[model samples]
Target: MPAARPPGGVTVRRLTARDARALTTLPPAMSWIHRTWGGPEALARSGCAWAAFQGDRIVAVACTYFLGTTYEDVACVTVPDPRLQYLALDCVDALCADMAARGHTPSWTCSTSNRPGRLLAWTAGFRPEREYAHYAVGAPAATGRAAAG
Candidate 1:
């Protein structure tokens, strides 16, 4: 497949199992890619992960980290550097395109508190499919913060 070239000369490409080692260097904010996929190796094994590399550094990643029975989930991450603005977005768009070509209906999720994640998901064309709610079953009244906390 053709690699995606984002601004600033970053190369975005689909990852292979052999590329697992490169994922290990993802910044802490992007660690969920490893956690959700059961490690970098398993993520690569999914055959649906991609990364944006600035030279030898993996500055961003977008992957189908969770394959669900109903819908697929994509997780994205990038170095929080302004110079890399849109780098993560480009990686996700490329990965999502790959997912679409495979006939997968991919969805994006984020901790309610993650503003950047929400923005990226929206920027990638994902709208809220559902807003989840939890029940306390008549417990004490809650504070102003809901799931967003």
Candidate 2:
């Protein structure tokens, strides 16, 4: 299904399954869990994603999910083509509006060195809280002990 455009041809409604295939082509770092777990079918089924399009092409995409109590993590991807910058911001605005309406306070996290993502999140109402370190080890085939052992 095509996105429902706004009166002034600005905002678009929530994403649908039709957008899934296109989004899958985005970089995995951007698509994150949506690419790994919920392919287009799951995106269509869950309806937790949205896109901003120009003409018939999606310029920006965002997939959001609840992390736990009181936290929702949003992953966003842009075409990275300079021509699509405005559309990317539009998607962010639309997504923030939708998240606010749903009573979910949104937060975004990226490695401190991830300059672009940090800048974008800041522009979209996210603020830097504190710096923290993260470590993870892949699970061993034989051990199920949380992958840290």
Highest-lDDT candidate = 1
User: What is candidate 2's lDDT per residue for 2-120, written digit by digit as tens?
Assistant: 22343243444577767666666666666554653456568645666677665555557766654445566777777777645555555666766767777877778788889888878
Off by over 4 Å in 1: 1-5, 134-149
7 in model 2: Cα distance from truth in Å?
A: 15
For each candidate, give its TM-score against the true structure. 0.78, 0.72
Error of 2 at 87 (Å): 2.5
Worst lDDT window (10 residues) for model 2? Answer: 1-10
Clashes of each: 0, 0
Screening candidate 2 with a backbone cut-off below 3 angstroms (N, C-alpha, C), the clashing residue pairs are none
Q: How far off is residue 53 in model 2, in Å? A: 1.8
Cα-based lDDT for every prediction = 0.79, 0.65
